[model samples]
Target: MSGSLRSREREMGVVILDGSTVRAFVGDEEVFNRSVDERFAALDLNGDGVLSRAELRRALETFRLLETHFGVDVVTPPAEVAALYNSIFDQFDLDRSGTVDRDEFRSEMRRILLAIADGLGDFPLQIVLEDDDQGSNLLQQAVDLEAAKTKAAASGK
Candidate 1:
């Protein structure tokens, strides 16, 4: 694959299962822990075992804000975003309860987090490292090319 394509793939967090553990990879480097259960607990808004659509929506909104503020390229379309919420609602409405409690919420949250993380490409750390390297190289090349151009201009040639 071309380097640019390979790098783009690396940017999209790809989780590979290694035995019982999940590991996120960027190129040859492992970046994220792939702990969906832990992440779900941390994001649970009400200290309940389950996560509701409101909580999930809050999380997504926060993610969107971070992406915008930080200039992150991850983008979720409006339709897909709605579908995601609907999927969670359907899953957590177990027993046709028409409402999600702690357990149901937690279960759905775990699945949603995993799915979102999976699509987000490597964890933030991995992306940062990769971008740092790429940025440095581009900067250096730009500097060198500018210097050459300057020299050519000076020679009036």
Candidate 2:
């Protein structure tokens, strides 16, 4: 196999060492790629293809409030979460241009999730992933409700 492919397999292996099976990799890279695509879409608040530091930070802050607003607590301490966000953001901004494009964010986040699954990283993967799903669902519901309201208003016009 090629070096890169071998490396990917190795990384996947390490990520699975903790006994949690993440479905991001099934037979190939497509599943993980799709997840990344979905997450990037959701994270891109402005619907742009890039995520500015400010945009991501705002999202992080909102995520921090998940416990209070949505009753799903992923419990990363406030300061630690901020530091972790900054660290991840720095790593994702490879070009150091102060922004992370979709591709960059997806790749980095994929790696993060994998490491979390493997119990190899400092990030609280299990709690965050589980609670993040709930949080995202809540956010999506809110967005859908707002859209419906707007549609209703337009119809009444």
Candidate 3:
């Protein structure tokens, strides 16, 4: 959670990731939508059908990209962390409803994922992802999904 981006998670292995892997996942509309919905629901702890700031914070923690469960690093002051979370919530609350509906959630998620893909841009790097198969982490699912498709095609041939 501090210093390096690498954080430890039990029961995970290093996976090579690049822009193509991320793009492949986002490109699959069905998988992407379903996965987003699942994660969104998980964040919607109250099942209110919209994400509250607290809920959105949970989602960001899952992301651990924009900010850690804590702020970016241990050195970051509390005020900056609060502002950071506020900015993120504002970004997602496109209509400024003070809450994020599914559409807004999906739209913002797509933008973030695409930006990550652009940053990676074919540069493969080994990273660890949680094995939480509950759709919390979709990138790994994407990799698995693409592998399954490849396997199916090979067997069919």
Candidate 2 accuracy as TM-score: 0.50
Which 10-residue window of candidate 1 scores lowest in summed lDDT?
19-28
What C-alpha lDDT do the candidate models reach, one value each?
A: 0.45, 0.55, 0.81
**Candidate 3 to truth, TM:** 0.82
Q: What is the TM-score ranking, best to worst?
A: 3, 2, 1
Which residue pairs in candidate 2 collide?
Answer: none
TM-score winner: 3
Top candidate on lDDT is 3
Q: Superposing every Cα of model 1 onto the true structure, what RMSD results?
A: 16.9
Clashing pairs in 3: none
For every candidate in turn, the CA RMSD to the true structure comes to 16.9, 16.6, 3.8
Q: Show pairs that collide, candidate 1.
A: 12-121, 13-121, 13-122, 50-102, 50-106, 51-105, 51-106
TM-score of each: 0.33, 0.50, 0.82
lDDT of 2: 0.55
